[model samples]
Target: MPTVTPKTAGPDMSSPKTQILAALRRASWISGQALADAAGISRAAIWKHIHALRREGYTIQASSGRGYRLEHAPDHLSPEGVHAGLQTELLGRNLICRRSIDSTQNLAKSLGRQGAPEGTAVLAENQTQGRGRRGRSWASIPHGVAVSLILRPKTSPDKAPHFPLLAGTALARAVSRVCGIWPGLKWPNDLLISGRKVIGILAELEAEMDRISAIYLGIGLNINAEAEDIPPDLASVATSLRIQAGRKIDRLDLVRALLEELEAAYYAYRLQGFGPIREAWKEHNITLGRQVRISSGREIITGTAVDINEDGALRVRTEEQELVTVSAGDVQLCPAV
Candidate 1:
């Protein structure tokens, strides 16, 4: 079963409470009869919704005769709300939302194959089966940024790996811009904040073995969730923007900025090749010039990221006097190195 995101603030929009609140917002002094009729629910249901909305920080005025008045509504995640918060045309032109999903990336891939445009986006409040690189799980903290962008690129299959690196870099830039914290790229797709994992990105592409069809880029960031909110396994490593910025950020605003950066970085990557994107990636990369270990399949290669190559591969100069290019691997830093 798909996970249902608990309503930490307001009631889920799909719930009857939101219907009551929305009705109140639509008209003042909404009579119980009117509200119930409008919502197609019982009068008792109307009262329940009113009480629930009030509990969720909605300022609802109630009167014996005048019925109910909605003074304020809890912020909603409407596409119009998110897009209005955005200033670019590259990230969220088309949006799809699900209450629960196995994975937003899988959903986005389905959309991409059906000819969803370049900026098509799929977002879920929670994921039942969210994943990261190498098929590892990414714990989706409810109300954070769990998004998948489906893009149909004009590039070949061999160059697809570079997109993950570029996407990771774009996310780092977006987080820095919104939260005012400098994050580092661990490799192709991990965001480190204060030397701990804060974000996970996974890139999946559909191809005909040699030609590319579409790419499903997934990014999951910890936001608003407290330190204790992280699971026991990730608590020691993963961090959230709220934890770092000292406040809950407006997710809509941050998402807008992230998509803009992704679009621009993707454009640059296609136009000028990975050289320029690599430079941008290196500037925010903490692994560069630092001692690190790369785990590829089974063998472990330790070295410094003297440079990232034109193809987005890491060029590590090992202590064994071997300069190795690892296309895909797990990166780690030796303690004290």
Candidate 2:
């Protein structure tokens, strides 16, 4: 049996508590009978949902004759909150939220194998074994955002590597919009806030020869964690939105913004190709004009980061003035000589 996870907020629009919360968000008195009629449930069922909402940190006022009114709602990310603010055509149409999970990518891949539709997403508050590029483990705090989006693109397998770069571009835009500070991208999929990493994107896919089956694009974003919350080894390099912005952020709002931007970028990539995404990427990228070191397995290359090709490969000008196109590598910015 799968572990039972608790949900502080969720995307299930049909839950009675979710419906009650939605109605209560209007800040007006809603009678029990009216709620029951709207929700298509009995008065007792509404009371049960009211109790559930209270447990979820909703301040609701209930009286024998006056009915119920919402005093305040918690800022937790819930299915109702995500749905209420969502403005996308496809992405996040089917969402699953978990309080704790091993990894949203694994869950999303399983769902994809089971014929889950394109734009299906899985979100988790805590990832026990979140993964990063090159099979490294990702550290996800309770305040972090870990989500995986499932897609079935008609593009060939050669375009697989560009997915994460597209995601990074979308993430940078979303983070900038929500935090009021523009984030810079480091090569393919890392977003840096104030020269420290705050977001990591990982994309995995299944394909047959040249045909593609599905892609699971995952993101781990540090939202509200502070410096001390990060491990000592990463304390200096890892930072969160709360740390960088000096204020707590609303995760639900950020999630909605991120999904909207991601959906728009994904659609544009499918319809208009990578031209728009590539330009936007270069605009937000910090690596293009810097001296850099790239590690590709046993070989290490030191050069000046020059450009990115149409296929999303990084172009590096070596000391010998030779232009090398790197498909994938661990890129590190070096001080100018």
Q: What TM-score, over all chains together, does every model reach?
A: 0.77, 0.87
lDDT of 2: 0.84
**Model 1 TM-score on a 0 to 1 scale:** 0.77
**Most TM-score-accurate candidate:** 2
* 10 residues in a row with least lDDT, candidate 2: 1-10
Tens-digit lDDT track of model 2 for 116-175: 999899988899999999999998865888999998999899999889888988888788
RMSD of each: 8.7, 6.0
Candidate 1, residues 105-218: lDDT per residue as tens digits?
Answer: 888888887788887888777888999888788788766768999877887889888888888778887888888988888787888887788888888878887687888889
- TM-score of model number 2: 0.87
